[model samples]
Target: MSGRAAAEKSGAMTGANEFKLTQGPEDSVSAVKFSPSSAQFLLVSSWDCTVRLFDVSANSMRMKYQHLAPVLDCAFYDPAHAWSGGLDNQLKTHDLNTDQDTIVGTHDAPIRCVEYCPEVNVMVTGSWDMSVRLWDPRTPCNAGTFTQPEKVYTLSVAVYTLAVFQLSVSVFQLSVSVFQLSGCVSAECLVRLALVMLTRCVCFQGYVLSSIEGRVAVEYLDPSLEVQKKKYAFKCHRLKENGIEQVFPVNAISFHSVHNTFATGGSDGFVNIWDPFNKKRLCQFHRYPTSIASLAFSTDGSLLAIASSYMQEQGDVSHPADAVFIRQVTDAETKPK
Candidate 1:
């Protein structure tokens, strides 16, 4: 379907204003991130081996840069700089102001996630090599590398805290580990959310982890046994057909910066907002043409950028073209009742 048609379908379902970008990545869009300070600019990384910065307010691609291989993830270090890594096994920093690119470092395996932690003033990259490496954004040097129990599938930052999902799909295992990147250069595991299933994506609003089995865990950042008791898991994105149950992986998640509520996107092509405090779903947007690969809420929580792309989680198959939909969100859709 065309971008406009998809937007119409989505807008009708949630009653939220929506539009499609005039241009999008050539291949599957791996990630969509809004700037830390402003919502007008969005950073997108794709399997096309390029990262593009889009001026969402104007619906135009402002700048783009290429990588040797597919770019898996990208994050805005600040308004002027972006950090990205992917199949090339290399980490790169791009100066948005000058449009210059520099190779920072390399990982043994493909990098899956890139995140900037402002509180600690550090850049973090997670990889399939089973390690999380820290880089000093100012100096452009590797500060430290910490090993994980399994391959790092996703990483989320909440203040000085970093939440990492160590996943092993073959055995259906997952470890939700939290690291405090404060005083020391090396990271220390503050807490583990217990061994679960294969985790496809995670977002921090008190550290939320979603698995491939259509289950999501909401846990608190505080490691105290009492606060841990408040943590719970719920099943979603599952359908029953002909008495058989089919579960889709929750591929992406983003939290509303203002409301503290969150949205989850799944391979089922659906996105839903939830009130974690109330354990209720606020609303579910209309399904897209294909899988929902990534999601990002603008800084002030007035906008949400959704990437509908094919993840190939079921292996290579026919699917719709990749697209990014920018929706004007409201308190009714994001704010908890």
Candidate 2:
């Protein structure tokens, strides 16, 4: 089959041949993740304010636990516990096999994102209040908090995005790095989030173009510093006029673990993979029907899982309509030049 034909046959929009894993409710899945171990368990956070663990081999729920607020995100630690954050501004860890949960730490504002760093045994939480907090997972306590300037307007509240990584142990020393992105003010915020570690130092790439009406100006930051500085280094090259108009705000970004590549998914229903070092677009996947809210790469960097949402309106009530899609990223030469 041709590339397009193969994509359509493999699932695309019909959802007929797609490997669908339904949990909670048809629309409740907010985030879906695979464990970092060899077992490859699937963990999901839902709009029902709970985190559900599934044994993918059996396609069954192994465990579920409720949180203080809607569970926005969940990730597994290296050992066995799962870490989660949500609207309650608290980070909670749960042991799936034991059915126990403990609040590890609290944020000053609604928690928007959570990630586990196994190399450092740390949990990172981002908040809508413009700050990212780091916690010790073993102790369930705050290790450090990175704060940003407060917004002047309620609509301008900073929603943070975070990524953590560890530098390779070399002849020098061992170091752990945390990267964060803050100050997003767009209907479809496409913030580029990444952690590129050299031998001893790490650099974070956070990019979101500032906009007046709809036009955007990009900004960059390195989170390792005490005073986070803006680099304003990159610009979005207009690929196509219609594409530019359709460049929905970016919702989630993931970097290739082994290469200089990264992918950005947006509300515009497009996932663009780029080479950050060369500042070139490698491939574009544009088959999504809604805004891509979150993304994850398999530990081996072979597969990508995307969480997406569509807007729904009922009388006066407004809620996000969501779904998950798993895609395989192929090499550049394998795709059409």
Candidate 3:
């Protein structure tokens, strides 16, 4: 085994309260999200064309369902219902109670993000077709479709606001736009900001955007000039060795529900917790075996699920095995000092 693999194995064996999922995805994991109401169940979507429901308490996969193509993202509509979209350009809902899958709708291109808005009781999907679609989860029908300036890359909904990140016509730039969701599926464009190469986004009291250039930006939803001035961007996930610097993509972000602090995972195989409100980094964990494809903190912020999967970005290199790790977190590591 390579030295890096040996070091990772040693760390996994010694890390406190950390355990690897023995029955992980066959291909790269695209998303890992916990149940909205409970931490015991986890929802995982993978490039293997499967979505799995795992019982973390029992450390076993409860069940799994298949798709025609690789699943890109998945969300829990409720405790027993899951919503997923994929390269097949199809939106599907799985009924855990009955082991049934229903085709909700289809996009013009591969679906990139799937999210459920509890406040509006709507299921929102973003696609590379350059459109955002809203669905009525109960009826599982398309409520509306809104065109975007470019291909939708990621989506995050906070309270009444929805933030959508898209690739710009310029190959080097990304556009970040925010929308206000009114009654049910009604959406109104609020603001648009341009940045460099966005890869992932997450929204809470405000919005946090990560770029392929190893940087992260924190922006607010308010339109006031003073409120907007508080927005700032910083660099991370870069290393300097032998008089050269290597930069990696920041792939995932998950917020701690109770503390409002957030964690970011990168291709550098590192996870760092930050207090965005205070502009401070709380802690940085030891490196994993490979890149972090996705991350999710349990509803109560007591556990964090890390998806360490190789993204094949380096081309024809020796790739590490894909795996998922569950770690019990503590207040000292997540809470602001």
lDDT winner: 1
Clashes of each: 0, 5, 0
Best by TM-score: 3
- Which ranking of candidates, highest TM-score first? 3, 1, 2
Q: Please give the lDDT score at residue 20 for candidate 2.
A: 33
- lDDT for each residue of candidate 3 in 58-177, tens digit (9 for 90 to 100): 666889999999999999999999999999999999998899999999999999999998889999999999999999998979998999989999999878778888886557467877
- TM-score result, candidate 3: 0.94
lDDT for 250 in candidate 1 is 94
- Full-model lDDT, candidate 2: 0.53
Select the stronger candidate by lDDT from 2 and 3.
3
Q: After aligning candidate 2 to the native by TM-score, how far in Å is the CA of 219 from where it should be?
A: 8.5
Cα error, residue 299 of model 3, in Å, equals: 0.4
Instruction: Score candidate 3 by lDDT.
Output: 0.88
- Per-prediction TM-score, please? 0.92, 0.63, 0.94
Error of 3 at 289 (Å): 0.5
Candidate lDDT values, in order: 0.88, 0.53, 0.88
RMSD of each: 3.5, 11.2, 4.3
Worst 10 residues of 3 by lDDT: 1-10
Q: Candidate 1 local accuracy as lDDT?
A: 0.88
- What lDDT is reached at residue 161 by model 1? 87
